[model samples]
Target: MKQAIAQYNEAERLARQEKFREARPLLEAAAKSGYGRAWYALGNWSIHGIGCRKNYRQAFECLRKAVRYGAGREALFDLAICYETGKGTSKNVRQAARCYIESMQAGDPEAISEVARIHYWGIGVKPDHSKARRFYLRAARRGDLESAYLLAEMYLTGEGGTTNRRSAIDWLKRAVDSDDAKLAWDAKERLKQISAVTM
Candidate 1:
């Protein structure tokens, strides 16, 4: 276990220094040694082509191992993504929703937001705007910028509750405070549209 931790730690350092090629083998070694986080890192790297060429199949395999090894809630979220997108696997929205729900129950904020999306769109589940709104609220309050933006939209359109412009404006402001330039810009534009309509 100590050897695995050491290898994993060294791999992380190498990755941070942009020495991804050098890190890959070390991560793999740790992963083979039963280090769950090492599997998680390898899964992400395979998906993004960080240290190796993009290989969705490898990513799917590694993520499954990560989940089985208790990599954490994030592993479940990524696995859910794989199921939804069919990245290196069969497309299964029902399974995707199930995994997302499990991760949400495990306290993954991203999973909460995704589950909200499933409910909002009736993706492999019944259309339940109220449940979506509640889930989005939970995610937004947990500091997910995208969730904040979507929740604001829900408030504006009365998707699951009464249309409350004030609440929309508030949530939009929160999204505008995010570091994500696209989301911040959209929130700002939404605020302007509201102002224009009101005036």
Candidate 2:
């Protein structure tokens, strides 16, 4: 285990230096030693064409092994995205939801919004606006500014419950500080529109 971890750490250093070709063999060696993180790195790198040709199929296989070996929350999140978008695997909302929820429980903050998105849009299941709203609110409360924006949209549209303009405004205000520039701009625009309506 220690040797595997050492190899993985060295591979990570090589990757940081853009020596992806050299890192590949080390990652493979670590993965062969049953290191989950090495499998995860290989899977992620494969998809991005870091050291080899971009191969979603290969990435998917590695991700599955990574999850099986408890690679960490990142593997679950990436697997969920693959399942949700049919990128490397068949589109399976149920599987995506399971992965998202598991990732969220494993401390992946972004997974919360993804779970809400599936419920909000009814990707592969029935839309549950109430559930979506609840999940969005949970994420927002956790300091996810993008989730605050989504929650505001739901409030304004009355998707889950009663339409509350004030609540919408409140949520939008929270979202205005988002690090996502586009979302921050949109939130400001929404606030302006709301203000214009009252004036």
Candidate 3:
């Protein structure tokens, strides 16, 4: 484990120095030794061609290996993105949704937000406005700005059910206080638009 850690550190240093060619072998060695972080880093570098050629296949392989080692929610999130975008595998919205759910279960805030997104947009699963709202609320509670905005939107529009102006305003204020200025602005606008409506 110490040797693996040393090699991983060396790989990270090499990557930082723009020596991707030198980093790959070390990263691979560390990753093969059960260093999930190294696998994740290698996946990122390979996917973006950061000092290395863009190879979705290679990136996918790295991420998958990390997943096998119980990497983290981020790896699950990335894999979900890849599946959704058909980077290394066929575009499979169902698979993507499952991945997002798994990531969320692993406590990934972004995955919670993504689950809300797909639920709202009816991307892979059937349109369930209540489910979408629930997901948004879950993510928002976890400090996800996007989910906070989405929850506010749902409240203001009453898309899933009757509108709740009070909840909308409250969540908007929370969003603002959370320092998500973009979401705060959107929530404010939505509040304004729904101010006249009554239950």
Best-fitting candidate, scored by TM-score = 2
- Any idea what lDDT model 1 has? 0.91
- Point out the worst 10-residue segment of candidate 2 by lDDT: 117-126
lDDT by residue (tens digit), candidate 1, 101-166:
988887886788899999999887898999999999999899988898999999999999989888
RMSD of each: 2.0, 1.6, 2.8
2 against 3, candidate with superior TM-score: 2
Q: Go through the candidates in order and give each one's C-alpha lDDT.
A: 0.91, 0.91, 0.83
Worst 10 residues of 1 by lDDT: 67-76
In candidate 3, stretches whose alpha carbon ends up further than 4 angstroms from where it belongs are: 16-19, 176-184, 195-199
The residue-by-residue lDDT of candidate 2 on 1-199, one tens digit each, is 9999999999999989999999999999999999999999999998899999998888998998998888868799999888888988898988888888899899998988888988888875578999999999999999989999999999999998989899899999988998899999999999999999899
Across 1-199, the per-residue lDDT of candidate 3 in tens digits comes to 7888899999888878988889889988998899888888888888898878899988888888888876866688899999999997788999888888899899877787788888888877888898899988888888876677778878878987789878877787677665667666776666666665643
* TM-scores for the candidates: 0.88, 0.92, 0.84
Using TM-score as the measure, what is the rank order of every candidate, best first?
Answer: 2, 1, 3
Q: Is candidate 1 or candidate 3 better by lDDT?
A: 1
- Using lDDT as the yardstick, the better of models 2 and 3 is 2
Model 3: ten consecutive residues of lowest lDDT:
190-199
**Model 1, residue 76: displacement in angstroms?**
1.3
